[model samples]
Target: MSKFFTYLALGLLWLLHWLPLPAFVAIGRGLGWLLFWLAAPRRKVVRINLKLCFPHLSEAERERLAKDHFAMVARSFLERSILWFAPEARIRRLVRFKNQERFDALVGQPVILLAPHFVGLDWGGARIAMSYDCASMYAHQKNPILDKWLLHGRTRFGDQQLLSRQDGVRGIARALKAHRPFYYLPDMDYGPRDSIFVPFFGVQTATISGLPRLATLGRATVLPVVTRALPNGAGYEVEFGEPWTDYPTDDLEADTRRMNAEIERWVLTMPEQYYWVHKRFKTRPPGEPRIY
Candidate 1:
């Protein structure tokens, strides 16, 4: 039954891909509002995240932001059908690169493509995968069938290498030395083991120090990769921001904080598209209470 349901959901998504792009925006907004009401736990999480990050925003403003965020989340989920099954030409049509020459200029050198958790993050990664054989890591999903599909869709183009989390930093280091652009997703609360309590949006959030550590280990340059799901049905922009000059300095914590700071700046531009639904502040300081 689980397998059957998985296929059924995929089938629905496949059908959804055939619709006009505007329909995704409209349908996603309606579906997102429905989910905003129905998915209580997630709505709470989003609310908490927004409150922590945007402390200045009023209750009603955050309330509206949360609803709008769900719409982008739903739109991203629904658009996976287009990403997974659509032709290369169609996918290319939907996703474009800004400052692409900068990305191209980095060819043959190791780079850490630092992508943060935006609703359009996956689309940006997919855009990169369409052209380059990038390497990135993933936590394995519990369902084997779904896991297979996830990987299949991710690696369909560019022969990209999606290493399992267990592969560890060794896998990433090797990929970097190979001169492949490492498609790295940096800002996430992956617990407190290898993470340090860094100031994210002025909140002491558990942020992974892997970005600096890996860059230092791999001797790679760090590039900020941001994706904006353009308003309406125009398309998505996978923008490669200017490379950091003095990154991975002696201070690991400070480096990670810089990463968080950059992400926070970008998040302000499109607050709704940021991945606020995640329990980013779930891991608190030793004496501190949980934020979620």
Candidate 2:
């Protein structure tokens, strides 16, 4: 039954990939409206996250943000079809790179494309994979059929070497030495291990201390990669921020804290595009009540 439904969804997505961008996003937003209601558990998760992170917002405002976020999440999910099935010229036209000079300045050097968990991450990843032979980590999907589909979508464009958690940091380090830009997204609660509680939106969030370590090990400069889904269904805009000057200084936790701070700044620009449905604060500090 699950396989049947997965195939059904995939078939629909494959067909819908041919639609124009505006129509594609309109359908995705409709799906988002349905998901906002149908996906009760995730809706609750988004609510809690918004409440925790944006305490300043009124309840009504937060509620609207949650709905908009669900729409973006749906669009982000459905839009992968464009990356997977669309032609190279089509994708290149869709994802526009802003301030490529920042990345271009550090050409021939090991670089880490630190992409935060925005709704448009896959879109951004596909864009980067077009030009650079990148190395990135991916989680195994439970269903083999869906996993295979995801793998194909990610690797279709460039020489992308996707590593699972089991591959360890060593694999990425080697890839960096090989000069493949690491399309790293290290923003999530991966339990208490190797994660230090850092201030994310004033909450002591358990963030992995891997970004600094990877930059140090790989000798890679960090460039913040932000992919924004343009309003009115224009297209995606991927902006690469200026490279950090003195990153990964003597302090490890401090470096991780700074990383979280950077992500907060980016999220402020487009809160709805951030990954609100994720249980980001699932593993709270010791003796603290569970968030999800």
10 residues in a row with least lDDT, candidate 2:
20-29
Instruction: Tell me the whole-model lDDT of each prediction, alpha carbons only.
Output: 0.89, 0.91
lDDT, candidate 1, at 61: 98
The prediction achieving the highest lDDT against the true structure is 2
Model 2 per-residue lDDT at 67:
92
CA deviation > 4 Å runs, candidate 2: none
**lDDT, model 1:** 0.89
Model 2 clashing residue pairs (backbone): none
Model 2, 190-230: lDDT tens digits are 98998999999999999999999999998889999999999
lDDT tens per residue, model 1, 198-227: 898888988989999999999999999999
